[model samples]
Target: MIPQSHPKLHRSEFTLGVLAGGSGIRAGRRDKGLMIAKGRTLLERTLERYGKGFEEVVTCCRDNAWFYSRFSSRVLCDVEPGQGPLQGLSALLAATQTQYLAVIPCDQYSLPLDWFERLSSALSSTVIGVFATDGGTHTPCCVLHRDVHSQVNALLKQGKRSLMALYECEGLAHMAVPGAGMDIDHTDALHGVIRKPPQ
Candidate 1:
C-alpha cells in the first residue's frame, strides 16, 4: 500500500533527509562531498537521487554551502560542530513538515530511481522504521516515522553517534534496493554505480 493511502499519512507531506554530515575522514579529510569521480561531485550525485525520489531534498554538510548552490536554500550543514550524524538527524527531521521521513547517506550514489517505489510498497502506517536492503538491513539507509523523537532524542542526549542503535524502534522492516546498496568507501564505489561487473 502507498503511504498516501494511509489513514494518517500522505506522500506529499513526507520529507527526504539526505545526511551528509561526515568529515570525510575515510577519504583523508578530502571533503568527500566535493570529491569528483565522473566530473560530478559526490554531493551532487547523491542529491540527484533524492532530488527525484522525494518532495523535500536537504543536504547536511559542514560549513561550505556555496558549492551546492544549485540546491541552494535546501542545503544545510551541521549547526553544532562534531555532533555526529545521529545528532544531525534531529535537526534535519525538525526541518521537515511531515510525518514520514527517509534518512539516506550521501555515500550511496548507486541508488536506483525506482528505489522509492520499493520503499513505499514495503511500508505502511504501523511500521515505525524501515531500511533499504540488498539481502540484509542496510544500516545507513533507512526510513522512519517522524515520531522517532523519544528514542532518537534520548540517544542523542547520551552522545551515542551510532545510527544502528536507532533501528530499535518498534516494528522495524526491510525493503530491498538491488543495485542501490553500494557504498563509496574507496575509488571502487563509482564502479558499481554505472557499470556491470563481469561474471
Candidate 2:
C-alpha cells in the first residue's frame, strides 16, 4: 500500500509510471527489473525512489505480472507484446487516469527523485511532452500529456517503435538533466553499474 505520508495529487495533474518491458536480449534473457542489486530488485528500488512524489505508481511490462503487482496493482502490459517501448507507452496512456505521466525506465536507477517536478515545471500549453536529455541525445525518460493517447495508439498500430521518431512526429520539447544517463542495457552494463561505488 502507498504510504499515507505521501500527498495525493489529482489525477488531472500527474502520475508516475515505470517502463520495464524490454526484451532483455543483452541481459541473457533475464528480466532486468527482477535483477537483484544491493539486496533489492530493480523494480522495488524504482518504486521506492519515485513512489512518494506521486499520488499513484504503475509499471508497464510485457510479462511478470505477479512480480510487478507486488509494487502496484496498476501493472499493465503492452498493447502488443515484443514491439518496444512505444507499445508499452500506448498501454500506459490508455490506462492512466491522470492528465500527464512522467516515465522512467526500470533500468534507470539513478534518475533523481525530483525528476517529475523538474519536467512538470517546464510544461506549458504549447508543449505536449517534455523529454529528459543527457548531453545531446534524448533518453527514453520523458513526461507526456494524456491527450496524446490516440496519436500514440495510431503510431503503435503502424509499427513505429523508435521514441525519437515519435518525438519528432509529435514535435515534443526536450529538457536536459545533467548526469542523467541510461547505463544498463545488458549484463555487463548492469554489473558495471552495481559494482561502482555510489558517488
Candidate 3:
C-alpha cells in the first residue's frame, strides 16, 4: 500500500504508458509486442503483469493502432516511425493526462506487482521521476511527473533521443527492483521464457 503521506496519489492520478514502438531489429523485424509467448501476446502479458492500479493506459506503437486500441485506453503512433524507444517515450509523455505516468516496455514481462507503487513513492520535490535498476538501469520502467513532458521535448529538439540522456537531464532517482529489467529482445529469448500464471 502507498504511504499515507503521499495521499494525493490515487489511481486516477496515474496513467500507464506502454512503449511498443520499437523497430524490432533484434526480434527479426517482427513487432515484438505482438509476438506470441505461451499463447499470449507480449503486449497482453505486459499489461496483465504491471498494468494494475492505473485507471488509464496509453500505448505507443509504430503502426497497427487499430490492434493496439483493442488493449489500450488510447493508442498513439510515433510521429517519426522506427526511431527508437526515446521517440516512443516522447509520444507517451505528450499524450499522458494524469499527474503521473508509469512507463513499461511491452516486452518486459517480468515486472513486480509493486513496481508502480515503489516508483511513485520515490517521487518528491527534488525527484521528478524514478526508474528501476537492479544492477543496470531500466529506463522504461519508470514513473515520471507529467511536467517532464517539456524536458522530453527539449531533448528531442536537441537531437538527443536517448532515454539515459533524459534521465540524466532530470537527475532522475532509481529504485532497486530485481528482475524488473528482464525483457524479450530476440526470438530465441521469447521461446525460452514463459509468462507466469496470473496471481
Candidate 4:
C-alpha cells in the first residue's frame, strides 16, 4: 500500500541515482542513456530533473568506460555482470556516501517533480524506504536505505538479479503516484514523449 503524505526530509542525507545499465534489447542494443530526444540525451534529460535536488547524482552502467569519458565523473560502472538492475543497484549503493538512495531509470523521464521529497519524508527506522508507483512495486523508481546494502550483496552472491527480488526484502514500503507509467522502453515509445525539433 502507498504510504500517506509525510513531512519533507533533508535532501543532503540522500543520494539520487539513475540506473542506466540496460543492454537495450528492446531498443536495438543502443544505450538508452545516449538516446536523443528534444536535442538532449536521455541521461542529460534525467539529470536535469533530479541532478541538482540531491546531495549527489550518480549513474550505474555496465562495462561502459566510454560513458565515463562522455559524461565525466559521477558515473559508476557495475562490478558484476549480467545481474541487471541488481548490479546497477549494487553499484549505486556502494558509490553512495549518503544514508539513503533514490533510484530512477534513465528512460523514466516523466516522474513527478516532487518524487524525491515525498519518498524522503516517508523513510524512518521501521520503514527503510518507499518506492514510488503502485502500478508495480518493483519498478526502478524507488528509494532505499544504505543499511540494506548488505542484503543486496547477499542476494547478488546468491545469483539473484532483479529489482523485484530486492523489493521483497523486509521493511520496504510503496508510494502510489498518479501518471507513473511513462517510461520509454522502445523506439516507438519515444514518439509519445519526445517533441519534434523546431521547424
Give per-model CA RMSD.
4.1, 6.6, 3.3, 4.7
* Whole-model lDDT, model 4: 0.73
- How well does each candidate superpose onto the true structure, as a TM-score? 0.79, 0.84, 0.90, 0.84
> How should the candidates be ordered by lDDT, best one leading?
3, 4, 2, 1
lDDT of each: 0.66, 0.73, 0.80, 0.73
Better of 3 and 4 by TM-score: 3
How accurate locally is residue 169 in candidate 1, as Cα lDDT from 0 to 100? 57
Determine the C-alpha RMSD for candidate 1 after optimal superposition of all C-alphas. Answer: 4.1
* lDDT tens readout by residue for model 3, 1-199: 9544544465568899999888888888888889998898988887877787788999998877898999999999888986666788778888988878888888886667777777788787778888887677555788888888888888878988776787687557788886677887788888644746322
Tell me how far the alpha carbon of residue 199 in candidate 1 is from the true structure, in angstroms, after superposition.
Answer: 18
Which residue pairs in model 3 clash with each other? Answer: none
lDDT of 4 by residue, 1-199 (tens): 9876545566677788888877888898878888888687887777676556576777787656576446534888766655688778888888888878888887776666777777767787688867776465347677888887887888989988876677778887777764345667788877655542111
* Candidate of highest TM-score: 3
> What does the lDDT read for residue 75 in candidate 4?
85
Model 3 is weakest, by summed lDDT over 10 consecutive residues, at 2-11
For model 1, the run of ten residues with the poorest summed lDDT:
190-199
lDDT of 1 by residue, 12-99 (tens): 5568777777776666665666778678777776666545536766667776677655663477878786877777678777776777
Task: Output the better candidate (1/3) by TM-score.
Answer: 3
Candidate 4 vs. true structure, TM-score = 0.84
lDDT of 2 by residue, 6-57 (tens): 2333323666778888878888887888987778887776666655657767
